[model samples]
Target chain A: MALKGNLSDFSIIQLLNLITLAKKTGALYIESSSKSARLIFREGKLVYATAGMDAMPLIKIMARSKLIPSSMAASLSERYRSLNDMELGITLINSGYLTQDQIFTGITDFFKDIIRGLFTLTDGLFHFEAEEPPPLTSIPLRMTLEDIIIEGSRQAHEHEDLKSEIPSLDVALKFAERPGVNIRDINLNAEEWRVISYVSPKNSIKQIAVVAKLNDFQIRRVVYNLLQAGLVELIRLNNPAAPAPPRMIPARNPVEQRNLVNRVIDRIKTI
Target chain B: MQTQTVKIVVTGPFNAGKTELIRSVSEIEVVNTEKKVTSESEKVKNSTTVAMDFGRITVDNDLVLFLFGTPGQKRFDFMWEILSEGMLGFIVLVDSTRPETFREARGILETFRAYAPTPYIVVANKQDLTDAWSLEDIRVALRLDSAIKLLPCTAKKKSSVKTVLLELLYAILEELDSAKS
Candidate 1:
């Protein structure tokens, strides 16, 4: 039950429960472009966690060894404001509140769990890039680079199909060279975006045909547009039956439902 | 590039427990001005940030987060454009206690579909109330998208709160995966 993947795939909370379900114990290292967090679990329970920024003290210690304005860190510490834990450490270092070493001290002091890998599960690093307004840093953590690769690979794979399906889509994607495609100007509408988002190699034309509410020819046209944009990778599905799960859900009676609402309202009024 | 910061707005139409959910799991005290929210101000409150609450939680100290709760009223819908854009994802709260909340719930649901369709989770809050509504019932009432995972929740409980947040993060990441593929 304790599965592993990028932070882009699972949230820490759900991952914990999955681990809790399996009663697993291991170290999970989750990374994105800027930083990494490691969670250590012992028999399904969390013990400690830390991130690459935990190495900041090592950075500050190095920066001080290099004399990169020790006061620069102290001055910026006061102006930093954010709700993210990992960002605080970065903000400190970038804002000049603490030298890379000072913030690293703060990170290790608080993020010791991340550095120690106390969790009993091992999850891969996510490689997500954060776009924000902030100052720059001199020395980056070693783990951050690995994440960037994973995320980049992830992006490249998603849009491969539409690129191949529609030659036009291929051109736009190559020309644009960005994650999102602008079918808005191309008369493709939002429904097209829905279909475009699902053009993975795992899904075939038929599977998409069922969900898209669009015909195969229409889908191909949309896929063609996507192909020109390099937004998807159209492929054939080997397991057509693997698509939709059965609807074990029961149908409801309209009168029973409205009656229930009325009774709940009456009860509330009485209250 | 560096680690990305996810600025998430957890909102729904009125009476959806947006504040309660925040209160349950927030490591820091969540600022709540609950009195500012009610049936009367539903028309013109156009986003007072009633509980424009703030909190922090460290996860292995790698993920930095900013949690925002917006009032769930049609009037406040305007602020959604500002809050939804640039957000990592969203967790939409659904009120299980009152069925009438569906109209507003549907409005926000459509907003998410039309605007912030990336990765989002739906929470069926107030599982503790007497005559508790079933999960299936809430889903049907809300007519939620099949892909959206709606977890039964009593935002006051730590376990419930934690699971909801986890599912929410999962949804966002999954959306990223879909986009990547």
Candidate 2:
């Protein structure tokens, strides 16, 4: 029987467990207006996964993490594009650029990032279509579902904790030094310092995401880490709903107030 | 003269038509953060507003109305408090056919009152539905104050939604007049 239902009714995590435990081969499709994702399984193990444009570039992340040189990663991507059937990891291994262990580690980190994003989706429609054998991406990484789900769950929990501390994604951020400390004295990695340079009290988290050319989740994670390290501060905008402290001087006389109300009522009558 | 922007908060229990009311009356395309309904929320609506819904209408050259629709689920209760901050007034929409949600509607009313203490009206929505409760019945079930106006409106109709806003503005004017005296 084909399995189809809302993610709310059956969580993605639980769905993954079911498919893996059953040792089934198929593709699971999940869609929401904001995002769509797919997970392919072969003999109950997750083989490939993708999520819209948010499927982050593994090479970029690897370069940022200092796992490989940016120039080398870019060159490898160009070379991989030219090949017809050669897989990226195999190509890198054959060229002696990265060892097999390094390629596998990079794959695990890349897939983990995508899985973490999928777990944040609380609402979406999902369906499982059985197949004789699942389709594979150019360089599909084979990993145990057990390990992926466990690590994804840990990342999901950490995401929730960060959200609690950084409540509104709309809140603005700015660089702030702790009391009696020199800002220049603090050590910062190239990426962390680059993100901090864009921090302005006027720039909301959403704006920061754009300026930094990173997705919302990645930018939020960076901001949360910076906050924990005492290198940044979140600026909560004054609630626009709060009643203004009684006006020092009335803006209008009673007659003016009445006239304004009348005009407003008259205009709404036409609506 | 300065153009006065008035912020009005629309709040209610799940599936009470807060989004519909704003969509009906807003002049501009509304900005809403809605996602597929998951968990227990699926028992009601197919999708739910997560963050907030925003819309705007100009009520003459000098005055503008900003409508904010708060998320319904209790998990988003913090959002209710956040959106209601600095609101000049609020509207509590109760689904006339869903009496079970009246308790939640009352709780939303109380939360807004605690935060703003401003003029408000209870909108008895879905009046077009045959199974909907009468205005008086809704008033009693919600235990509304006599001074509080109970307005029967079908949130999907533009005219009906406008009437609700007019009544709310009238109530605000009355409060201001009384305060001045």
Candidate 3:
């Protein structure tokens, strides 16, 4: 038998807490309007997680995080496309390309990413089955559900802060010119510098996220911090009266529209 | 002469072949953010694009076209808006077999028209399928205007995809020439 309920009836945090307290091992399946994912737990600890097609793969995430070159990640995916998630992780580890610590850290971040991605869902179906999930290959990842719940709450609060500062990730951003500020005085980390390199008035935060390989939340946080320090500025390009593309001819006249279609059809027949 | 780069957005509803169109036409490897389908969409395809698909192709030596494919679901419309910015033109690829998707494509087209008033064409994709609607039938079903260009294409065929691209390019070039005058 499986335990199931709407998220409205029982919040994800409370549900996970109850599972943690009871130390039940099972898999939790969550489904929303446009997204769904599964979290595999062992003795109340999350050992693995996977989501619907809207979510990128762990290999893509790793490449985005700069942990591995995108080419290497692509090759790994092509070579292990058929392997299950845990099996692929084990293969990568056995191949000596990834350390066990790296996989553990990666899996942990993946859990948080899924949690954060679906944190805003107030209504969704969840099924918790007390079945033994496939073993996580050689390295077992055991994450404290309580810690994840707490971290999720914290990030939700940060998301609220970002919501007010940045209108939308679609808004274009550009580096602000500083007349008096010394460049060397401000200590910039490599990731921050990399984010800076992609900033342009033409590139929206979403585009920057793609090039930077970071998730939207991570990129937005960087931009927020940069804005507060007067290092970047937002460009508003909302034009309500932008011209519509010129029509070939008015289609209101049925005779003219029919004639145009007929001529095109005749030309196509000849071709 | 300066290289003129045109950003064209390829969009439509679920399983409309936006990603396949870009993949078939792009010179560069398409960068896609797709994951396994786990919802009602699973009935349509195994995987769905979550973010956007990106590719590039050079046209006529001087024109470099950047192709961006929007996620099919309306939930990811924010990405569509983002991709539509400064785009020269766009193509809405509809799956002819699914009338519901044609409706979905219409909604997307309306939303995109309001966002970016660029020239667009209605691409009836998956035409190789026996059940696919004819161009005339699709036009009537979509309630498409005579002014809009409707092209039937098999998204998987590179030559067919290239033809669609060429037609869109001609439309865009016409729009650009008129804008200058």
Candidate 4:
């Protein structure tokens, strides 16, 4: 029904490559028939991605949440049809139906779930291989496994702490995903995956973070990377657990971990 | 030879001296409006540059600079690239007073940083203020890219401001020189 060379026709890796080559700084919004997808770019590096519908009706469910007027909801829904969520949020905020923070929050949640859903729908199999360097001469960006683990460990622990507060992982599982090669190549220390494994649940991110005793921001990222590589599906208990990404076993102590963050920060400062 | 004029943009966080720098250099007519913004149900984007500020300076009546200032707040950030297209380079004015702003500045910088590695200069503006930080201090605090040149300037002074702009042009010239090699 569509031309072959358009953005949707490209494979995930192809999409990533296109993004790198263009080095354009804009969000890419892609929809396939009934479904929609969004990816954000900062310069050449791929920062964020999402796929699936924004559950618009849930905003009315919050106990203390103000009841959104049917008129406003209907109007905003119309806007989403015409614009991507980022634009939609801005429009709705400008229209005074939603606050900027409110919409930003919605966008954040929407991206997370959309990303989770992205895991199940993705078809392309190519991924960053750990043992072997990415089959390219130049590195696309510095989002390597170390960054992943640092991000992942924090998330895993958050899941453990927030488990009971939110729904289970089943709802959290949305995006179609695959594992990146870095997970397999880097040897994760015991502490890292131990936290990651705990939060690999079938509900909301809260469940995994609470159960794993981890950080929310970091957990979201670990799960995000896992989903990217197709290692896990967003569907709750839809499939078996993914083999945790490789990490340097015998986890580093907290002191050592602090040093790593400092080291990375130091390197960036020098740059 | 016909003189060519190029538009150069000055942008970054609030109080990055975008307006002051423009006033110090342009031979005539510059506009600046200061407003204190309030928050609402949404994150109130405090930096209000509601419109583009224009300043003109004829360089040897050739290589003229048409300076455009953009809103520094995040909500208005979308206008950056739209304003930056086909420009020779941009001067990212840095406020040495507020270190917390460097992170926000970096975020903004990363969005537009495609090439011309030296197409920017870290003008540590407002250097003449009391208890003001030094250029190297701002440099380390901002975790600025090691590759770019850092300049200290008090945009309130014409010579100091012009010197910074000249340095930025030289940086571009140096990059162009290297590219030729």
The candidates' interface RMSDs, in order, read 21.6, 14.0, 16.7, 23.9
- Model 1 ranges with Cα > 4 A deviation: A1-271, B1-4, B32-51, B60-62
Error of 2 at A24 (Å): 60
Model 3 interface CAPRI class: incorrect
Residue A154 CA error for candidate 3 (Å)? 50
Worst 10 residues of 2 chain B by lDDT: B133-142
Better of 1 and 3 by TM-score: 3
Model 4 residue A97 CA deviation (Å) reads 71
Across A233-261, the per-residue lDDT of candidate 3 in tens digits comes to: 88877744554443322123334433433
Q: Sort the predicted structures by lDDT, highest score first.
A: 2, 3, 4, 1
DockQ of predictions, in order shown: 0.02, 0.11, 0.03, 0.01
Per-model RMSD to reference: 23.4, 17.8, 20.3, 25.0
* Runs of candidate 2 exceeding 4 Å displacement: A1-260
> Mind giving the per-residue lDDT tens digits that candidate 1 earns over B1-181?
3543446678886767777677776677987555543455454343335436565554323344567787666765566666666565678887676545654676787776566555677887887776455665456545565676988888778778777766666565555456556
User: Native-contact recovery for every candidate?
Assistant: 0.00, 0.21, 0.00, 0.00
Q: For model 2 chain A, give the 10-residue run with minimal summed lDDT.
A: A243-252
- Tens digits of per-residue lDDT for model 4, B1-181: 8775566678777667787788777767787554656645223345456566678776443345577877777777656766666455678887766544665677766655642222777788877775455664455545576788888888888878767766666665665556556
Better of 3 and 4 by TM-score: 4
**Which candidate leads the pack in DockQ?**
2
